[model samples]
Target: MWRTPLEQTATAALFLGIIMSQIVGEGSAVKVLSQPGQQVTLLCSYNYEDNTHIPQLSVQWRGPNNQLLCHYIKHKAYQNCTRGYTISYSPSSITLTIQHVHMEDFGAHVCSVSKPHEFSDYSMELARMSEYVTSAPKSGGDQSGSTWTLIIFHTLLSVCM
Candidate 1:
């Protein structure tokens, strides 16, 4: 399932999760299984019934622990982008592009927007990934994934012997 080069993300045990958020009112609450050094764009998009109409909008992208990456305000040139991060805007959406992704960059990314008579916010949370794509198994409802993997492996080994 990995499309990028191995050198870019060399951790077989390191799972990175790219939490997808579309109009996420709060944030994308999910685990991580994404590779480092890969670029990811968190988008804040709006869809109007009529494509011809555009609203005055302002946007801010915050990193983990309320770190401000950039902001695009209405009718303003107030620009602030930091290292390894970029922000761009269009009529319909604002995007936060993160480059050279590392462990430090892994966390909740929130996008706040203001418009005519309306205010909203969206978020994207990142974390470690897991081989079990669905959900991690629970041991008495409280066991780690690695422990479960070892248990299953031992069970299989005993059966083969």
Candidate 2:
């Protein structure tokens, strides 16, 4: 099987602090289910102690292969994204939107934000419904029932968060 790049770069720091942990109050190790050609957005949000003015904060969204999709420094947006991807950021959060998701896109996507010595980042995995179902082995019975069960489980996980 092909593997995503594990290069250590500024974006690499994203996996260090948390080692895959989400923001204080959010879901954990979530596998978002979707279909081919569907539009999807991965969001990374952070709450500040106060509405303090930010100075020189930078954010980057990387693909599964550790490819830098887009980078935003201060209020300026960089156009490194050319694979039908778009990125936008606000005071408290940054979002990466995929125009048309493909099978190759079904993997870990990361978002990193930084300023001076402090930084925060997180990653989310996207999987296709058909692929997910086939990879998940059910105890017994039809795949439809197993699929529904997995869907409900994911729903509950989202709700519990």
Candidate 3:
């Protein structure tokens, strides 16, 4: 059978489209949070065309030197969290909670999901706050609480201006 120019072009385009879809992988934005003592949770969500089969999720927390501090795999019940780190995962998202925030914990955390042949990964930095302020002083040690109250009042007044 002889194929016309238009027919040949259309067939090539369709074939390319199918190949592109399989080659391209899906990825989601990485989000980071910080807390005082509790572990900080990093959330990542992704979507793909093929969702019939469940995907395997993996999360890794790396130090500034690119050392793997923690890693979690879906099927493996065991996790290799750092001395002070913990990792967990759900079907579509992965979470890494650092037991106690350390200087080395302030680095990139990577989250990845994979199927039989496709996978995607993303990374984000976790930062630590140098100084933290307390709500109030216990037992009314001094006029600090009153000073804070005045500060809040002025802040709110300025915002309303």
Per residue, candidate 3 scores C-alpha lDDT tens digits across 1-161 of 31543333323332332333334433422223343453455544445323554634455656557887777765566578767766666555555656666666666666555555667776655654323334554565666654674455335434433
Q: Which stretches of model 2 miss by more than 4 angstroms?
A: 1-28, 48-50, 75-79, 131-161
**What does candidate 2 score on TM?**
0.63
lDDT of 1 by residue, 38-154 (tens): 666666665521266544667888988798888777566666788889998877677787777778778887878777776777766654433333435654577677676546443
Clashes of each: 12, 0, 0
TM-scores across all candidates? 0.59, 0.63, 0.51
Candidate 1 local Cα displacement, residue 71, angstroms: 0.8
lDDT of 1 at 40: 66
Whole-structure CA lDDT of model 1? 0.60
lDDT of 2 at 6: 19
Ranking according to TM-score, highest score first: 2, 1, 3
Q: Name the Cα RMSD for model 3.
A: 21.5
lDDT of 2 by residue, 25-142 (tens): 3434545555677666676766541388777688888878888888878746444665688887778777787888887888887778777777876677775654332334547756
**Which candidate comes out best when scored by TM-score?**
2
**Candidate 3: minimum summed lDDT over ten consecutive residues — where?**
9-18
